[model samples]
Target: MSNLEIITESRFTTVFIIKMLYAFMCGAHLDSIINEIRELEKPSKNYKRMKPATKFIKQPLEGLWHKHYEQVGLKSMAMNIKQQMGLNNKQQKIFNNTFFKEFCDIFNNSEIPQDKRIEALGYLCSGKQYIDRINDGKLTGEWIIYHHCNGKNYYLNVGNHSDGDDALAQEIREIALFEFPFFKGSLPIFD
Candidate 1:
């Protein structure tokens, strides 16, 4: 088997892993969870103001998405985004970098099922539905998710808040989830 293939090891190595697995399966990645925790860590950031949500922008995002994807590490973009929101803070920026680094670790681990990875990638699309926060000045985070396109190189946001991303991952997952249910494999769209 290729080194990238998903191995058949038991995923329930720990309760936290189990919970994480279930949560990811249900449309939330560690990034989102981390971001949520970060929000809680700073109540002044309107701790309870945010809510999870899903949205669609039928218009293609090719322009700005690609621009941000190419310019610099997401950390810069994340900082720029936060700065624009007047919520720029040092601690949270650090969390974003760590979250992205961990995301890579999870992406590379063979023990993680490809379907699950696809599910994570699926965040780019939303069968399970990419869970995103509603009120946390995270509108800019959507762009950060582009770092995960089909195993392409991913760059972490350097500064530090834990919003590995917001809209970007959800938009991708939404697309993936939306497309997943209709696939017939080789069965043909109609026999």
Candidate 2:
């Protein structure tokens, strides 16, 4: 059978789909997806030792562990798919660009709902909270971003540096790039 068929096949495909969905929802790339799946798989062993209330509880936990491992397996499978389909260069670029552009646009437009805009902006500003909020569609609005003409100007006029500095800002930008590298040309680059 074809690779696409394998990705669509229910049993194997669900894991692949979940991994991709997780990656997309978390604003991560394939590498991050691989890392997350690896992390998920590692947690399964710890879960194995835990005593469940009953067989029903244990079975679900076991099923969850299996699913986690399956996602890890799918990460390898995804690599194969990336190579086989030439997704590494062409398709990857297209997907990244489209995803980021859409994500950023959703944030910039006030016409978008306040909660969603806050959530998108939160993702741009804070990675940890972003991931948590992604699936739930909740907005924390705790992080902030500022623009400045110069170092002194940024420090003095923008806001408190204690909240986050240029270095942190740079990190956020880097993470954004990781999620959507192809979007370099499309996004407004601030100095």
Per TM-score, the best of the predicted structures is 1
Against the reference, the lDDT scores of all candidates come to 0.34, 0.35
At residue 90, candidate 1 shows an lDDT of 78
- What is the per-residue lDDT of model 2 for residues 1-191, given as tens digits with 9 covering 90 to 100? 74323322222223334435544454434443333233332334433311111111231111111111111244434433333323357766885676577667877798988997888766544453233333332321111122222221011011112434444344434443444344344324321
Best by lDDT: 2
- Flag regions of model 1 displaced more than 4 Å: 1-92, 121-132, 135-191
Per residue, candidate 1 scores C-alpha lDDT tens digits across 71-164 of: 2245544444444334346745765565466567768979889888776744422221112322333333222211222323122111112323
Error of 2 at 120 (Å): 4.9
In angstroms, give how far residue 7 of model 1 lies from its true place: 57
